[model samples]
Target: MSKIVKKTKHKKKGIKIFSSALVVLDSKSLVFFDHKTFFELKFPKNTVNDLEIVGLENLNEALHKFIKENKITSNNIIMVLNSNLFFEKILKDSGDIYKEISNFIELTPFEEVCSRTIQLDGETRILSTNKKLVTTIKDILEKEGLDIQLVIPYLALDKHSLNTENILEVNGKKDLDQLLKQLLPYNLLTENTVLNGKPAEKPKKEPKRQLFLQERENNPKSKRPLVLLSIFIALIFVLIGLVLFMNRKPPEEFTAPEIHQSMPLIAPIGSDQQEQTSGKTVENTTIKVVYDNNLDSAVLLTKGLSSLGFNSVILEKAGSESNTSKTYIDFSTNYPQSLRDKLIGETNKIFVDTVVQDSEVSDYDVVITL
Candidate 1:
């Protein structure tokens, strides 16, 4: 039977929260489609953070992990302009013939644009072309072996800061805004959301924002009540302590215990191993895992072995069957994610212990994924 000790006390270190990342960037190779001032670019009531970048090639992997941890896949992102590499050239000659012309021009190689953003997919429309150099950027893409599917014609245009209502005279932007209205969805920006229309009255926030406001409304009162309660609790505790001290019966703890002593030999920790604190107990253990595929799985399994207080964990892939008529296991950790994902690709095969296999992969310890 365990008794709750009232007087006996132990000190503990307060827990520290591990900070989470909201944004992870590859580099400054970005272009901002910002219509608002930089001051308005951020949220007034939310927190924003970024991560360190290594290189462009590893950008996808970094973004994958970042999105996984934040539990968010899509959000408004700000991309920086790489001034050293990117250029903004407003072509005037290819206005009406943009789609036909840009298809040939983007293939023209600009060494500066080579390391910059690649065209994902886009439509071309002439922004009043006068006359300029035209070339397709296909050679650069071919040199990189990138299969281009999206031919998004990005205008190498100069940044203009002007609102439609403010401008009294039209400055050659007649059909562009109409075309822009059609293309707003592709930009992921709000439709009819530009400076042309009467400024929206900042639409009433959804219920989501109301929750925050409600929390704020309750916070001050809650804190005040909490403080008052704490003071009351402290007063009661002090009273009890004072009473106990005044009429104390005294503690009977003069002698040390005469329990038998024993010699213990602790095995030295392995070089690749570390001590594990599980829940509230210390344990000596050994773990074993077998994974037939994935270099990362092998690495993670080895790491889990030591992290779990295990003596050792061994992993071995299933080899070609020793006997005839053995079914082949198309095991992989590539794009498919799991066997089910690769199931349509690999049919007529019996799955042995599918849940058990997937559970170990699905129930991993990390907050993010590869």
Candidate 2:
């Protein structure tokens, strides 16, 4: 385990700096810290469903009542979300940390989640929470006119010193206080952190696989096998050419034939016939266009597909709150390769960041996301 550092600022002797209120929220209770003391508010039974606060009105009333009774005046809030609402995994530090994180998220079963990464000594700590849960809490806090400074997971606390089961007990208050003192300096969540229920945009860089290939190609020791293979292939081609040269026949067989032959005439297909054939082929293929914060682009693309004689429909757009910028074209496994190629080519012409993939369980033959 690493030691957490408590940051202290040097100020003039008479200046007073107010401390921000720290609030710990879990499935069972809500703990509020004010003036170096912790206040607990236990939720009623059945109020929480699946680690989410389902009774919004009751929760709001309870929170306001607790604040009034406790006289907690601080508007700056630092929230600590308990483990029940989020998932945590410590991953060994790979050279390509971003790619590793992406792979982990893709493998997870959750479709919509907010994730944050913290770098440790030799590992990366990933904290992912249900997006809906986080969004609900944020909305409640914002509605109360509170400024949420930072939001972190309960895993940030020292496991050895603090008991996870008794997170709000009196015996652990000292340990929890010390941990919060250390965590406050880090400012885990900043303005730039986007936790708006969308996957974070990854920084553009060469993938780890491509970088490894480039490194291998640059190394002289690794080039021997490639050089040998190339030489062997070249030798085979050279021998083949020589065999053809040796088997060459003399060019003394140019005598014209005396017998006359009748050739069958073929009629060229007209434009209308070509149109009907293309329309029939395209009409059999159905396309669904889905968009996230890009309805205009999706509509235009759908119209373009319709004009091209393909059956296209604009599916319900994804949540506008998402910040994903990439365009994706998903084709069903049974979809025709020719149609897939045509759709992919057209999509690429329209969107610069186009990703082509095959979805085995897609309902539509083709699904486009803009």
Candidate 3:
């Protein structure tokens, strides 16, 4: 038996894993899944009114605290907005589809809305939602340092289903799991499918402009030959004048008046002058302020920089792994010292604990990290 016994080993294949987190949001609640755990948060009763998402501040605070406690990184997060908040319709494949979509949006009850369209075999599916709603939610998530990969409407999951009215409504864990299963294989986030609405159409070329140029180029009696003839005649006149001048008698020289010497029109490039010019140039340069926890201070600093004639933008740093104890001013090595001092001064006015350093790898001329 020992001699006849033989064992065969089978190899175990690796399973495909999803590293991204999926978040489903509705007017009432928000559901999050990170491949291993599921969490849900319900909004206050007065969260949504007829006009806007009124509970934005509360929602922002809740999201910030939740993300911090859970230690969720800001990377590869997908947001699915519920279908109840959107206006969905399947439009016929007309020649100008976007035009039709625009008309549809105009006729919708919502005053300002964003739309996304998907073209099927013969029909186009268009989904639109209130612009303010999407913008509010986007700002909230971004403020918490979540890198949103895609903002999609729930109707996109089952576009062809007849009863797609409430198919994507997440009532409990089972519903959320089913929705995730369907969404696992869906990855169509083209320009036309983004929450910002339909992709902008390229400007049509003006045929009249082209026609005018073409006619001028093709005319048999064109002005090119006339111009060349006129130039040739002018050259002949110049040559004749030169010959006359050579044969003429020389004029008597008159005593020239003594001229006084004046200062040079442009002063020499001194070190101090170069530094001043560099400082002026840096004043107009753009400064980027990256913030993690203190958004208010970042906003104030941005405004202050703008007031000082320096164009500035505020960006929320992605992830909670930031040194929030002290603010950092990262300037390029070639950045002028005077300009750096001014930047540091402005930053310190808003953020008290500040540290200045020269960075060789910074993308901007000046980056203030808070």
List RMSD in Å for every model shown. Answer: 41.1, 37.8, 41.6
What lDDT score belongs to each candidate, Candidate 1 first? 0.28, 0.60, 0.61
**What TM-score does model 3 achieve against the real structure?**
0.39
TM-score of each model, in listed order: 0.18, 0.39, 0.39
> Please, what are the lDDT tens digits per residue for candidate 2 over residues 1-370?
1112112234335433355555677767777664445577787654556666678788778767777787666555667777666566786646666666556554443434555655544455766655555656667766666666656665555422443222322233455465455554333333222222223344468333321001222345567898999999999999999999999997797888797658866777554464454452577776788777677777777777777777656467765555667888887765655666678777776799888888977777778878
Measure candidate 2: CA RMSD. 37.8
Q: After superposition, how far is residue 78 of candidate 1 from its true place, in Å?
A: 8.0
Q: What is the lDDT for 223 in model 2?
A: 76
Q: Per-residue alpha-carbon lDDT of model 1 for 33-132, expressed as tens digits?
A: 1122111122112111121222333444343343344443222221111222223233234434223323333433321112111222232222211011
What's the residue-level lDDT of 368 in candidate 1? 15
Q: Compared with the true structure, what per-residue lDDT tens digits does model 3 show for residues 145-247?
A: 8877666665555453412222223344565455545443232333223222233443244323221001223334567799899999999999999999999
lDDT of candidate 1? 0.28
Best by lDDT: 3
